[model samples]
Target: MMRTLFDAELNKLNVDLTKMGHLVEVSIENMIDAFKHQDKTLAKEIMDNDRLINDMERAIESRSFNLILRQQPIASDLRNVTSALKIVTDLERIGDQAADIAEIILNFEGEHAYRTVEHIPTMAKKAKMMVHEAIDAFIKKDLSTAQMVIKMDDEIDSLFQEVKQEVTEILKENSERIDYCIDFLMIAKYLERVGDHAVNICEWLEFNQTGTMNDHRLI
Candidate 1:
């Protein structure tokens, strides 16, 4: 009976994680749309929605802690709960980064600031995919999918470099648009950070599955 209850709670924890992941995925999508259209209203909406993500994080944390205290989970079960705690932290940061990008969009004064860099949207798309896949890997306990998410980080980093080059060229052509270029550069950086958070999530998932991260025992 105790084992059954513990298993049910574990399943509930995963369901909450999936719900939080979906919220983050939608925020990233809305962030991309807001950037493309320079929709201040949508950007503000995304910022407002960040509170929901934060609340989810806190709720997940409490649940994980409750499981640990009540169930005294050991070995793989302990790793599972602990990993959920780490994964939620990364997911919360991803939400914050998305909100940060939205805040940048809200500050844009020119209509074409987003048009100055062509690579940011692609970078955001790839980061979003990584986050989505990482969450899926967690739910399915699929180490291969988690590893693939880690590999995808390289592409996001490469695109970030491309954005920097493109911004530098734009500055060379028109020094007056420095502020716009800088804002776009910051957006690219945030998306790059988002990719990093996704990688963190995957690493924690890997640790959960194999008891090691980067081949070093964590627990």
Candidate 2:
């Protein structure tokens, strides 16, 4: 009976982690849409939803530590619980990055978007995909998928570089638009950081599977 209960708790841990990941994914999608339309209402909605993600992170952390203390999980079970503790932190930060992007959109208000806006949607999509794949890897305990997530970070980084260069040209051509261009650059930087957080999650997945850390930086 005790073993059965422990197994069920492990299942719940996986479910909770997945729920947290999905919330972050939704935030990314909505933030990008809000930026594209310059919709303050949608941006506010994303910002408001960030609190729920934060709440979920705290709850998962509590549950995971409780499981460790009560069950004293051994071997792979202990790793899963420990990984949950690490993974939730990354998910929480990803949520913050999404909120940060939405806040930037809020600042843009009623202004005309610069040409650099064209690069953002694609960058956000790549970052979101990385997050999705990393979470899937965790759920399935699939090392290859986790490695793939790490590899995809490069494309997002490259896109960020392109955005920075384009923003620089825009700034040089039109000094009056400096504020807007800088905000756009910050948005791109946040998206790049989101990809980094996804990479961090994938590294945790590897640790969960292999009992070792990957000392590599994807960014």
Best-fitting candidate, measured by TM-score? 1
RMSD per model, one decimal: 1.2, 2.9
Worst 10 residues of 2 by lDDT: 109-118
In candidate 2, the residue pairs with backbone N, CA or C atoms under 3 Å apart (3 or more residues apart, or in different chains) clash, namely: none
Score residue 191 of candidate 1 by CA lDDT. 94
lDDT of 2: 0.87
Please give the TM-score that candidate 2 achieves against the real structure: 0.93
> Residue 136 lDDT in model 2?
85
- Where does model 1 exceed 4 Å of error? none
Superposition error at 5 for model 2 (Å): 1.9
Residue 64 of model 2, lDDT score: 90
